[model samples]
Target: MTGVRWILMPLLTSAACVAQAGWIDEAELELRFDDNLPRGQLKRDIKSDMAVAIAAEGGRGYQLTENGRLTLTMTLSATGYRQYSGLDHVDAGVGLAYRHKFGLGPLAPEARASVSATRLEYRDDGRDGWLYSAQLGIGKRITERLGLTATYEFERRKSDDVADRLLPTVAADVYDLTSRNFTLGGDYTLSSDYVLSAAYTLRDGDIVSTTLRNLPIFLASSAIAEDRVFGRNRYAYKMKATTRGASLGVSRVINDHSSLTLGYEYIDSRAEGGIDYQANIVRAIYLHQF
Candidate 1:
């Protein structure tokens, strides 16, 4: 009995120490400004309309163990349209995440899983929709300053048209779509205040459109020809799209728990049977910790 108590006392003390070191808590707020103000292929002269958006997000984190953490985030955003002439719309989203770390000798690996729900409402059409997504990822810490991550994501969107007149008399038109994406990316930390990142993404989905119209023969024929040739119609279109993008940025650490980042991203996307689109975006982000 004496020998057993001696062993058990030290073991219990060690367990208590580990438990005390296991838990952590953190919170953060991020604000971003984006101006999709048109240029080049997105030019207002050609597209004739542009959207400018400002978004803000807040998150809270809880650590379950020394190597595992969970986070919850919420976002609210709005976009103003130019040339299209419509009231600004509000968008909101919530996300939950989990991350864990493991290691093998000199190599360290991290795994992450997340789920999110988003809602968007438009004032002009009084149309609203919901989207849900799940993602899984694994990453390796190549070095103290560099790491790589690979991810798979699946998303589904459900939308109902607010204009009942737009539905066909013979059949109801309810539109829904599902999209899946695979992505790989790498990140490098240049210094305590700067970082660089790049990513490539592939996406596959089907988009459905419905149109209700009464027109003469010539107009109808023209519309059909345009849809067939230009790939615009009231039907379901299956598509595979690929996007290649890179971002270069400098981050200024405001304090122990805050940062401000300015970055530029260039993206090029091509679809199987549709016109290619290219975009360049400049963004400013501010982060706060609590």
Candidate 2:
């Protein structure tokens, strides 16, 4: 938590120095279904599940200059999983961001940078963690109806280190993870009230996989633990992996301050020692801004 404080203290101080004050608030509810909730590598280990999450955030933005703005946000969220109750969690986070426009006009290129820290508490103690992230992005409005964005992000997660009694030497903090990823996204206005969105992402990092006991994964794992979320006999292993994914979505504006979105995402991950997995997710989200 000390590291998280060092990153956020400066931003909090800047908020007191700001002369401009404008509040931004938003709330969101999401329902999702995952065909591979466990990130399982074997068909026998795959566990499908559905979840619901709700979140709210409020922020203040300061126009530091004609083309630069700084914003700070605080957020709270909770999620409930239908089958994997251990994955249910509550999260609280704070974010600070800055954006600058290179020139005036709707077509001007913009650059953004942000940092955030979140604390997540799970029903299962082993999954409890702190998540930290930093990102840099660029965006441009190519036309009145089209916008594009690209971003690179670095993330770190910290979690409990509960060692198995039999494998005391094995690392047990499977949720303590680190990753770097790049994303490209675009949005096109289809009508006055509808938007079409798409995104592609490439990620290289550590991933946790749960499956029946196997020698290949057991040998490659940096961390190992019994994961009751899937089944009593299932075990979780942490391994280095690379993932590529894409998403497609459509959103309908309900009014000036609300919208509903339906989306689908597919991800393929390749881990060490010839292990691989794929996941398909369907989601519906509703958001309102105040």
Candidate of highest TM-score? 2
> Could you list the CA RMSD of all candidates, in the order they appear?
15.3, 7.1
What TM-score does structure 2 among the candidates reach? Answer: 0.90
Taken over the whole model, the C-alpha lDDT of each candidate is 0.55, 0.86
Off by over 4 Å in 2: 1-24
Error of 2 at 201 (Å): 0.4
Give candidate 2's error at residue 179 in angstroms. 0.3
Distance from true location, Cα of 149 in model 2, Å = 0.7
Question: Candidate 1 on 1-290: residue-level lDDT in tens?
Answer: 23223323443354345335542122222232323222112233122233444455567789999888999987665555544323346667899999888954334798999999998765444335787899999999799888899999998876655223323332222234577888888878888877777677676653322122223221212111111111234222222345566666677787887777777777665554343446666666665544
Clashing pairs in 2: none
Residue 51 in candidate 1, Cα distance off native in Å: 5.7
